[model samples]
Target: MTAPPKTPHPLLFAPAASQGSVPDTEIGRLFHEMDWSATPLGPVEVWPQSLRIAVSIALNSRFPMFVWWGSELVNIYNDAYIPVLGKRHPQAFGGRAREIWNEIWPVLGPQVDEVMQHGRATWNERVLLVMERNDFTEETYFTWSYSPVYDDQGGIGGLFCACSEETPRVRVERERDALLQRAQGTVTTLQGWFDNAPGFVAVLRGPDFVFEMVNRAYYQLVGHRPIEGRPAFEALPEVRSQGFIEILERVYREGEPFIGRGLRLILQKEPGGPLSEAFVDLVYQPVFDVHGRVSGIFAQGHDVTEQVRAVEALKEGDRRKDEFLATLAHELRNPLAPIRQSAKLVKTPGLTAAQHHWAIDVIDRQATHMALLLDDLLDVARISRGRLELRMEPVALSSVVASAVETAQPLIEAKRHRLSVTLPAEPVVLTADPLRLAQVLSNLLSNAAKYMDDGGAIEVQAQARPGAVAIRVRDNGIGVAQESLQTLFQMFSQVSSALQRAEGGLGIGLALSKGLVEMHGGSIEAHSDGLGRGAEFVVHLPWMQTESLEGGQPEAPQGQAALRRKVLIADDNHDASTTLAALLELDGHEVHTASTGNEALALAEQLRPDIAILDIGMPGRNGYQVASEIRRADWGRGMTLIALTGWGQAEDRRQAVAAGFDEHWTKPVDTDTLQALFATPGRAGSSQAGPAR
Candidate 1:
């Protein structure tokens, strides 16, 4: 038997020179080696025209194509389809479709069977395909089509498939999903930090102060009430009346921070909860957006109710202490008058030389010392109670320094201390009381003199600066200790050693000076390079920017002292009243005395004295009432009323004015002061150009 050599399938071979049919692909070469006559489809030339045409189209195409041909529905695919078949290539190229695709058969069998059995076409977009590739099942997606091919009988023979894998696109979406999860985890950790913070923190958006974010502390602060995505006023209505709303709006508009310490606010946190008072130290800071515009506010603070309540509890004790100091000052002045009177009385012409020297010593050493001590105590008490008031005027800083230097010159000379003063050539103007301003400088100078070695040098430098004037009183004396500097300006605060205590002050000179300086809208600070290294005190006062002084000290009134006038004096303290009357009579003025306010009123009506010095604390009617009565009388209208009181506080002076007094003086009113009042040319209720010191 002679076996004829098998002819290879024409569609799989390289295109011949005349035909130009087969593609140059792996599948093309494999198709020529494939024995189709032994399989169900048989040889390519004897195959039905429709089947042959389908095979020709499948093998020659460049796309990933497959042809399921003949009644057995055999598998056929191109070179582009080998990657999709995975390990099933070559063997699957000629096998039955159902047998080759057994793993994904449930999904692919119906698409194939419908097209082949019913002669209909089927399409699938992004269909799932679990296929073994490289000996492992891979999760893949594909877009595929199955179109029917007809035999010569006009019946469905097989399905032609065009397919593509969508695996790469699906894998990218999974990676994106993982990234989103990680971002959410980071946000959660940041939110956890905010929740556990100690202070109440909240973020509010816009000028409305709407709560956009809140933490655990903030929630507990409002009694664990839910508050978010709502305006602060609407969520915490109690804050509206406390001006919190206004502060928030202002901070948002101006981009400035608003702080409130111990701010009392009443809130009803829970339903039916009683309105409770809360004191918080809160700050409203502006929060800007990415565009650099203020978009919200960051509210944070702590509750301070306990601290505020403790301060409120101590107010009554403070009041009683002030009263005790006032009484102590009044009692000390009682003995001072007799000592002063005895000193003056011993100065008579008949006295011996020894008695004269003794009297002079008593006057110089005892009386003056006692008087100054008493005055310092009274000044400190007044300052502590906020009773000191400044009579402000714009005067040259040079003039003020000059006056202050004069006040301290006596002590400076006694100590043989070298003093130098540097003033700006251009005048520096400040709105302050010339008397108080001078007192501030004098106190610092005296303090320096007392603490330093006897001959130490002191310098007073006044420099002009923008918006303020810096007056520095520096001394090459015993400098302050580091611990003492902090309490130097506190009333009753002293840090002198045993030897330094002999300076004979109440340790309140700096304290009083600080009070007066502050009242004039200035600040005082103490600086030192440690003990014995020299000290410097700098005082800065807000200065007026003008070429000239607005107002200044009034000049002394002269000639009126020689003019005699009738005066009425009244006092509950007999020694004070008689000594003052005797002093007035020494000035060649006729004087009358009364022990009570009623008696003074009667005397004023009866004698119609030119001047009336009414004692404030007297039996029966008070001096204020007596003054009121005297002013009502037609004959007493022209009388010059003066109020004398141990109570020389600002309020007391104001009351004196209300009572028709021309001037007011505290006790221990020196004879010179009394004489000066009459010398100033003015009646009651006139301008205080030059009154008693």
Candidate 2:
């Protein structure tokens, strides 16, 4: 059996010096100086050996340590544990544990009781505790362990605890975790923005420019290839020689961004497919790592191929327009020189009759040439503006061919070219604008004549196709180039400047002919082996099924009868009014002239003229006002009103009729048309007037 331990003598157990001498810390000094007679644990000098040993250990500890001794569970802590006590330090040194930490008694009571009653150790990590150490209750966390303390007889005395406050570290960890979550959310939002962006976006990593991240538009730009994670050049081998790879590498190496507009690239569009041209407005921006070094490039751009092509086309059109203007000036001046010289020659005093006649012929021919040029220009304008009206009529194809040959005979014979005409055995009939059909054929003949060398052979062949009549004009001289065939009929387009200039043309005949042919629901095309290899222009017109040519013909106008009438001519131009009056007077009609609207009205009222010709632009009052006033008068109501003016637009003709005019004629009016007007009834000697034009 073990021997029972005996208690030492009081003098031997008690401190020989002061109680404060046993502990070197502040808590030790306070404990020794305190009056413990009033506590259950009694005086410090009479305390049990276990309680003294534990108190000494607690007071000397550097780490936070606390001792709860005897039945009252009085508090005693080290210097490091003072912060946990807050303002309860000196008082809590001798205070009961329950009272000092009453705010947290619910949590602390079980752990303390387990260690005290069972003599078992209790361990708690990061345990929450709420204590009223200061004026306010504070939230705190501590990692601590409680171990039982024993007295001299081996019975449990109280609990000794070792602790560390973990409040600051726990709060720091929580804040760090929250920031990481927010950072991840921001990254996801940024990725979403990139995916939905309108322009193409891509990310390339490393020196090989490997595609890392790409958006929806980026896939479309590259024809939806599975390119992500692949090197750019390896995915699009066609772009290897296109210099895009070099550009991206340069941006990465230089750490600078590159922006390009309308940059050209040749791409395959599909795997192992033929290459096609592409244009883009792009930017390559270098991405940097934390060390301030370029790690990759961000590629973003638009496929601007259509816009670039449109801009290029516009530039070409502008250049062509400039060239056309220059050509127009040159052509217009060419005729003026001869006309001026001929007029001077005709006025020479000693000129013979033959010489005067020759001079007159030269002037007439040049004037007609100028008129034709102006007519072509006006026709183009009217067609472009959708104001030209075609007179539809049923006509035999033979008649149209005869009319066209008659009109083009002068040019054809002038070139001294041998022409062959071939037509299908069956007569071709068409419901077409007769004059316009003849005009289309005449233009083709003239074009053929102009492009060929003198005396070149030409052929005009017509055959009946399934649904149409095909007329082809073939020439053996200066054939059109294959490349120029596509743009041959474009307005003001010339195959070659030297050829067109030498041939004396304004470069609009083919374009005008094309417009006229298309207006008749037909198509025209040109074909040639190559330049100098001969060429052919083919015209296709819709066929009409007809039996005999009995009623498929327009009635010819009756011959003008020899009738004299009183004529009134009003014009602001003296030369125009005088010349017109002279022509009508020579036709045996008594003619009067007026230079203003007021004069015209006075003359009409005084003479009650059979026919009144008025100009739209006049002083005091315009022709519309004069015509309106004339129709309101008594005797003037029976007179015929004719508007002869320079304004020839469809709107001008409508306005002329609205102003009570019987006819609207654009100047310079054809002499034959004016003669036809004079032959109408109710002009001085006739019974009744004809219908208004």
Q: What's each prediction's TM-score? A: 0.52, 0.70
Off by over 4 Å in 1: 1-354, 357-361, 364-368, 496-501, 550-554, 558-560, 681-693
* Per-residue alpha-carbon lDDT of candidate 2 for residues 1-693, written as tens digits (9 for 90 to 100): 999998664333547354532556677667667778877788776888778777767776789998898888988788889888889877887899989888789999998889889999998999878777788877788999999999878888888999999989878877888888888888888888888788889999989999999998877777868889999899878788888877998998899999999999887778777778888999999999999999999999988999999999888778777777887887788889999999999988999999999998998788787877888888888888988778777677788888888888898999899988998888887778888888888888888888888998889999986679989988887887778899888888888823454665777888888988899899999998987878898989988665346655655458867478889999999999998899888889899999999999999999988889999999988999999898887777778888998887778877888888888887787777778767755554232233334
Report, for every candidate in turn, its global Cα lDDT versus the true structure: 0.79, 0.83
Shift of residue 577 alpha carbon in model 1, Å: 0.9
Off by over 4 Å in 2: 1-198, 215-224, 271-273, 497-501, 546-562, 680-693
Candidate 1 on 1-693: residue-level lDDT in tens? 999998656543422332345556788687777887899887766677676667778777778888888767788888888888877877888998888878899998777778867767888888778887678878899998889887788877777888888888777867777777777777787788788877789999987888999988787777766679898888887667877777888999999999888988788878888988888888999999999899999999887887888787466335434643554454455546656776776866698888777766656555666766677777777777887666776777888898889988988999999999999888687777888789889889988888887888999998887788899999987787898898677665556541344563555678788888888888999998888788999998887676466455567766555457788999989998898888778888899999998899999899988888888989989999998898788887778888888888787887887777777888777666666766655543242323332
Task: Give per-residue lDDT, candidate 2, residue 490.
Answer: 83
